[model samples]
Target: MVFDFTISKQGNYAIISMNGNLIEKGQAIALLEKAEELTKEGCSQWIIDLEKLIYMNSSGLNTLIQLLTKARVAGGEAVLFNMNKKINELILITKLHTLFKVAGSKSEAVEILGL
Candidate 1:
């Protein structure tokens, strides 16, 4: 499937729902740009919903790390939720699970971000 994403606001956080395959940094440029815009708007906290993501490669992982860095630089945080089994395993294998805050649901992600 082709990569796509939607951005929405929830409280003080931005919810980024990703869909389809994510294997290239170019595909995430829009996402990163939107994140930067939101950060400037003082809505830096993020919840990345991966439930619809069909596949992800190393570049996808890098994109996530970039998001986390952006949030932190903005004095906020990013949480991930609704990850599929394969994605979860990839995170664990890469030891990124420790680098990221993950939740089982959107509500939980909001709680993690304290929003």
Candidate 2:
């Protein structure tokens, strides 16, 4: 599937829902740009929903890292939720699980963000 994403807001958090294959950084430029815009608007805490994402490569990992960095630089945090088995394994394999806050559901992600 082609890569697509949606951004929404809940309280002070920005929720980013990703879908389809994420294999290239170029596909995520818009996402990063919008995240930057949201950060400037005071919505820094982020929840990345990956349940719809069917596949991802190293570039996808890079995108998540970028988002996490942006949130932290804004004095906020990012949590990932609803990841599939493949995606979850990739994160673990890369040791990125140690760098990211993960939750099993959106509510849990929000709780992790303390919102």
lDDT of 2 by residue, 43-111 (tens): 999999999999999999999999999999999999999999999999999999999999999899999
lDDT of 2: 0.95
Q: For each candidate, what is the lDDT?
A: 0.94, 0.95
Judge candidate 2 at residue 7 and give its lDDT: 96
The pairs that clash in candidate 2 are none
* Regions of model 2 farther than 4 Å from truth: none
On the 0 to 100 scale, the lDDT of residue 70 in model 1 is 97
